[model samples]
Target: MRIVVPIKDNSGLESEVCEHFGRARYFVFIDVEDGKVKGSEVIEVPFKEHEPGDLPAFIKEHGGEVVLAYGMGRRAIAYFNTMGIEAITGASGRVKDLVEALLKGALKVDPEWRSKGDFGRHEF
Candidate 1:
């Protein structure tokens, strides 16, 4: 399986997961087979600032089947789903630990913060 995780640096599995998906400094793509990691690659977002739906499109082009993010808005989640890619939020940790937990089915999804109440949904 190919999983895309947005992180703060180029530290490979040691990179800290970024707090916002689209705002992450780098995207680490990890490949897993038989419950073990095969390898990982990094994607640096282009120099141009992001626009709506840009990152999602970039992820789709990179063979990403799933996304592990800190917190994402409902629209972004739905956008990924439409592309047949799964989005899991409320994830935070070093890249390796989070990947292990995900492979073990141990990452929890907090529904209260998922839909309309996440980091980007504020209208104030």
Candidate 2:
């Protein structure tokens, strides 16, 4: 499976995960098999400016099956859902660790947790 994790830096598996999906600076795209990371690549989010619809399209273009983000707005989340792409939010910590946990069925995503305040900032 192809999984995409928002990353703050591209140093290694220990790099911090980014908070926002659309505005994330970089995304660590991993190819998993048998619950292990077989291959991976860091793709830079084209620019800082992006709309809710653009996110899903970008994921689709990159052949992403799942998105691991710190926090995603309702519109963006809905867009991913519409595109049949799983959006996992409230994620923090290392990008590779998150992917590993997800592949191992250790990570549980709470899709119901919605931001009530400003949509851009990090809350969890």
Candidate 3:
């Protein structure tokens, strides 16, 4: 499975999870096999300006099956579900540690604070 994690920096696995998914500086795509991470890649969020569903669509286009985020709104979650992607929110800590927790089935999807789903234009 391919898991896409939103991060604050391009510090490889040591990168901390960003607070916002749509505005993260970088996105890490981790390839997992038998619950073990086989490989990974990081890329900048494609658009400096985000539309309602652009971020999720970009992740899906890059073969993401799941998304790990710190916070997401109802609309974003619904969009991800519609695209057959799982959105796991309220995440933090190093990316690798998060992945390890996931492998052990310990990375629980923390509850998200309700959002108005109103994000103004953001830059990369």
lDDT of 3 by residue, 1-124 (tens): 9999989999868899987776787999999998789999998876778878888888999999988887776677899999999988777788999999988989865564335233333444
In the range 1-124, model 1's lDDT, one tens digit per residue, is 8999989888878898877786776899999999999999998876447666677889999999999988776677888989999998888888999999899988765555454334663221
**Lowest lDDT 10-mer window, candidate 3?**
112-121
Best by lDDT: 3
The reply for model 3, stretches above 4 Å from the true place, is 112-124
lDDT of model 3, residue 74? 65
Reference-based lDDT, each prediction: 0.82, 0.75, 0.82
Which of candidates 2 and 3 reaches a greater lDDT? 3
**What residue pairs clash in candidate 1, if any at all?**
none
Model 3 residue 30 distance off true place after TM-score fit, in angstroms: 0.3
Residues 1-124, candidate 2, lDDT per residue (tens digit)? 8888878877546677776665567778888887788988888777567655876788789999988887777787888898889888887788767877887779865454455325554222
The C-alpha TM-scores of every prediction are 0.86, 0.84, 0.88
User: Candidate 3 at residue 37, lDDT?
Assistant: 91
